[model samples]
Each structure stands twice: as C-alpha cells, then as structure tokens.
Target: MNIAEFKKNLLQDKISSAQEWFFIISVSLLCMIVFISSDVFLPFLPEMTKYFNTSMSLSQMSLTAFIVGLSLGQIPHGLLSDRFGRKSILNLMIPMFLLATLGCIFSKNIEFFIICRFFQAISASACIVIGRSLFSDVFEPLKAQRAFAVLVPLVSLSPALAPSIGGALSIYFSWRSSFVFVFIFGLIISLFVFIFLPETKPIEKRTKNLSLLSILNNFYIMLTDLKLLYYIFIVCFSTAVWWVYAAGAPLMFHKMDYSAAIIGLLYLPAVIPYFTTSLIARSLLKTKSVNYILNIGINGMMISCLLLFLLESFNALNVWTLMISVTLVTGSNGFLLSTAMSAGILHFSKNSGLVSGLLGTLQLLAGAFSAALIGLFANVFDKHYYVNLTILFIVCGSILSYVLKRKVIKHEAIKSF
Candidate 1:
C-alpha cells in the first residue's frame, strides 16, 4: 500500500466509535480478563496447598503477589502511555501478560507459581488500567459515563465469577488447570486487543518530558485535586468492600456449611448487585448531577449499614442476609463510581494516563489496607466480626460524607497544578 493508505489504516487501527455496543462489550471483556487473571486463582488455593505441601497461608501469597504487582505496575504503565502513546503501551502489555500467563503454566512449584503470579499481576496491566485510559481518552463526558456503565459490571464480575470458575476448574481438573485456563484467556484477550482495540492516545496527545519530575508532579496534582479526593474515596471504598468480602468469605462460608460448589454460587448473589448497579450508575449520571449522585451514594451506604446491623442483631445473617448486604453495598456504589472517576480525572485532561494511573494506584492502596484489617479481624470465634465490618463501612461512609460537605482540599497537592 502507498504511504497515504497506510496512514489511513493506522488511524483506523487507532480509533473506535464510542457509540457501538460491540466496542463497549469488547472493553468490558478486556477489563474482565485482567480481573479474571488476577483472581481466578483463589478457588484453587486450597488444592494447590495440598499438591505443593504448603500451608494455606503460603498459598495465599499467590493472591497477594498479584495485588502487589498490579498496584506497583499501574503507575509506570500509565506514565509510559502518557509519554509514548496509549495504543502502543497497551499493545505491549498484551504480550507481556500472555508471557506471564505462560509462566504460571510452566511453574514447577509454589515458589515459581507465586513468582509468576506476581509477574502475571504486573503484566496484566494490559487489561484494566490501560483499557481505562483508552476509554478515558476517547469518550466525552456523559457518553464516558455510559462507557463506564458498560465497563463496571464486567470488571466487578471478575471477583464475583472468579471463585466459581476457579473452584469448578479445581474440582474437575487440577488446580494447575485453572492457571492454564487463565493463560488461554490471556491469549484470547491479547488477540482481541491487538486487532479490534484502537489506540486512543493519538500522536498529538503524547507529551515531552515524561521525566520523573513530571510524573512526580502529576502524582502531586492528583493527590491535591479537592474534587478528586471524594472520587478517590468512592473508588477506594467500593474496592475496599470487595477486599473485605474476599478476605472474610472463606470462613463465613465455612460457618454456613458452604461447600466449594455452593460457595461458587454464593458469589453470584453479590455479583447481581454489582452488574445492576453499573446500569443504574450509568443512568444516574445522565439524569442526575454529580453532586446528587454523590449525596445519594453516601447515604445509601449508611442505609446498607443499618440493614447489616439489623441482620446481625437478630443473628439471622445467614447466606441471604450476607448476600443482600454485599449487593446493596456494591450496587449503590455503582452510581457513585462513574461520577467519581469521570470527575476525578477531568482536571487532568492533558495528562490522562498519569492521572488514571494515580487514581488506580490510590484505590488499590486503599483496598490493600482494608483487606489487611479484615484479615486481622476475621478470627473464627469472633461472631461480631461481621458487625464490626458493618461499622467500618459506616465509618467509610461518614468520611465520604465529610469529604463531600467539607470540599476537602489537598493543600500540598494544589501547588502542583
């Protein structure tokens, strides 16, 4: 082809129509694949313990390693996309992810598996954050909310579906087979990203001085964005709830006599709310104002807490109460998630990648902290653990309320912008 024709082809490869349902679905699947890769190993943890002759605690690190990798790797990936361009950085992550998947399959022991799991987490950046940057680059304000509506369910489904998928694969096959399943997912998703996914960051969008100082400055700008802090609170706590749930579920399910097969089903009830909320969140963004959604989501979380306390008070918090509480907590946040993310990064339109990265990183950091606290309280004898957790959620909700009312400023952060 002539140079002119080739240029047209490149642009075609670099852009997608924002309105298409297929594009939205494609974005959702890409988002799901990363989360799926990150979490699909959990169900297999017990089995791997037996096969590897290791403790459950040791096998747990495989999960921890993935979080560590994802948390640390996102910033650099975002920064690189900002400097070089989103499309190429996104493309590069796909292969890295595939290779990491292969590492899981080839690992001979727990040692190698944990190492590869960390690498997989590190490489899986191709899916979630990078995909987010692409959507952030291409979509407009209200339409962007629509895109996130499509995106959140699939992203949320990762955790919701992971245990079932991991559990089933482990039961029928070997735990190793589950890792193999993730590898295939990585391969398939990598192909989709290569062919259909276009680069949203055009040449003109790229900037000079992708230096440490610039990245540091970008980080500072995000931290100080007063409007963004509430958004951060929204994403982080939404994430924190999941982290808390995941941290506590094994024992909670055990207490309920939830077998592996049944526990897989347990995740379903929670996921329904998450997916439902995505649609609700998208609609609210269009029909309502940001302040309105923020107000409702915070209060809704408080309402959920009271419901949780009621359930605990009666000691009737069986599977049904647990499921409903989890759903309300996740679903209500859906309305807030879109508003928070869209508003959070609006000020940094010029530094989309770095801003997205910082937000992603901060949210994950919040999740990691919450997960640790949950793990600490999840003692087998402590029946009040769930009640205590309900209180924690209330605390998070209260802080969010303050953030909204006070218009909390990032004093040190302001000068960077």
Candidate 2:
C-alpha cells in the first residue's frame, strides 16, 4: 500500500495483517523491556553488593544511576529523533543498549556496574519516549488511547515478572546471567527493529533546524499549557507513588522474612488487579469520557492511599492486608497513568516526540527524586514512614486532580464556545 493509505488504515484501527500487529507488539515490547531492565536484576541487588564487595549504599546506586540517566536522556533523544528521524535513532540506541548490558555483565566493581547501568538506561529510554511518539505517528488520538489502554497494563506486568525471572536466574546461574539474558533479549529486539521498523517521522515533517533554542522554545510552549501541565504532574505524582513503593517494599518484605522469590510472588496479587484495570480502561473508553476515567482513577488512588494510612496506623502489617492495599494502588496507577498520558500527549500532536520526552522525563525524575529521598531517610525514618509518604503523595495528587478537573472543564468550555 501507499503511505497515505497505510496511515489511513492505521488511524482507522484496521491492523489486519499479522506483520502489522507484530510491529505494534514489537514496539510495545520495546516499551516493556525497559521496565524489565528496571527490575530484572533487583532480586540480585544484595548479591551484587557482596559480589562487588561494595557498601549497601554504593550498590544501590546502580538503580539511582539508571534512573538519572534515563530521565536525562529522553529529551535529547526525542529532539534528535525529531530532527534526524526515528528509525536511525532507534538503530543507534538499541546497539548502545546491547553494549551497555554486556558492560554490566562483565564489570569488575560496583562503580563500573553503576556506570554501565546508567548507559544502559540511557539507551533503553529512547524506546520509551519514541514508542509513545510512534503511537501518535501511526494512530489517531482515540485509537492511540485505546492502544495505550491495552498495552500499558501488559507493560505494567514487567515489574512483577522481571523480578521473578531475576530471582530464578540469580538462584540458578548467577547475577551475571540476568544481564546476559537482557543482552541477548536486546540483541534480538534490536535486530528485528533494524530489519523491519520503518521511519514514521517523514523527512518533510522533521524540524529543519537542530538548535537548542528551538528545542527549548518547543518545551516552553508546551509547558505553558496549564491543562497539559496538570496531566503531566498527575503522571509525575502517580509515578512517584509507585517509585516509593518499589523503594520501600523490598525492605518491608525482608523485615517480614520474605525471600526475593516470595516477594516476587507477593507482587502478583497487586499486578493482577493492575492488569485487570488496564483491560477495564480499554472498555471504559467506549462508554466513558477521558475526564471521567481520569477522575475515577484519582479517586481510586485516594482510596488506596487512605487504606494504606489506616493499615499503617493500626500496625496491620500482614501479607494479605499489605497485598490488598498495594493492589488498589497499582490498579489505580494503571488506570490514571494511561489516561493522563493519552490526554497529555494529544495536546502536543504537532510535536509528539518533544512532549513525550518531557512527560517521560518529568515522571522519571519524580521517581528518581523519590528514590533519592527514601535513600536519604533510610536510616532516620522508621519503616512506617513509607506509608506516610504514600499518604502525602495522595494528598498532593488529590489537590492536583481538583485543579486538573477545573482546568479541563474550563478548556472544554472555551473550545465549545
């Protein structure tokens, strides 16, 4: 088919061929693999400390370095892709990721390992920001939301699943095996992308000038949109809540005498609800408005946060209770983030790459900051402080939700008029 016809079918949701679906699924896999990267080696973190003979604090910097690099890398990659084209950026990044993974596998010390992970994260981040932009390139706004609804829940499964794989690999082979597995996975994916993935950003549509000022101007314009900013903050805060949970949960489970394998299993209850909610999100789009879905998601998060507060206050620290509370949080996160992302990116259709990069950067930075804060307070604060942070985030998110609702209503009214 010709280019116009192909785009028409995509916008119309006529993904008829197996290859088309594979393309979509492959890109989604690109998005999902990063999260797997995020957590696939988490189960081996303590082992890594011992293996490298590093302090606990230094060992944990592996995660921090990756987050920081991922956060920092998005904007530049997005801007460059917008200027230079997407396919080339993808080709460059995937190979970088392959190399970085190998570096991690062979690093002699924690410092080198952390540096390798940072580069690995930088390379993997291109897939995420570019993947979001790719949806806008191929699908119309509504179709893109539906696609996100379906893909995100599946993507959300990575955190829980990766750790299980990591725990198993660490148990059987070694910590290095986890990196090897990822390297092999990255190699295969990269080969597929290089061979099959076509450039979505057409030459005529690309920015003519590759200037820092032009990039900054694009960001300035998008950041000034109050409605867009609100959705961005919603994504940011929601991500922060999840980050805190990830940071604190391992310690909490350890205190409760759970091994990494068992902890991985415990995450399933929470993840199952999250996946179910994502499927629900896809269906909800047919009958419900975006604002309605977003509002409901916010309420869900608030309710989940309150339950966590109550449980922590009462010292109800059992597995079942903790599972239920976290399930609510994860489910609500799945609900809110997917919708917020769709709405936020729709506002910047003229520059999807830039906005996707900004949205991703903000969310990752929020999570990074939360992780840093948790690390800082690890010694000073009690374990229950994690729950307190969750409550605080919900309070902040609730206020942002209120503002977002008001702004969205006003924007809609203005558009209607």
Among the numbered candidates, top lDDT falls to 2
Q: In model 2, what is the error at residue 104, expressed in angstroms?
A: 2.8
Candidates in order, TM-scores: namely: 0.87, 0.89
Alpha carbon lDDT of residue 70, candidate 2?
87
* Candidate 2 lDDT score relative to the true structure: 0.80
Every candidate's lDDT: 0.72, 0.80
- Per-residue CA lDDT of model 1 for 89-173, tens digit only, reads 7677777777777878777788988988887887776467777766567666677667777776677677767766876786688
TM-score of 1: 0.87
Model 2, stretches more than 4 Å misplaced?
1-14, 17-21, 46-56, 108-112, 309-317, 379-384
- Each prediction's total of clashing residue pairs, residues at least 3 apart in sequence or on different chains, is 0, 0
lDDT of 2 by residue, 23-137 (tens): 6677778887788887899878888889999898898889889888888888888888888888889888998998999899999988889999999999999988888887777
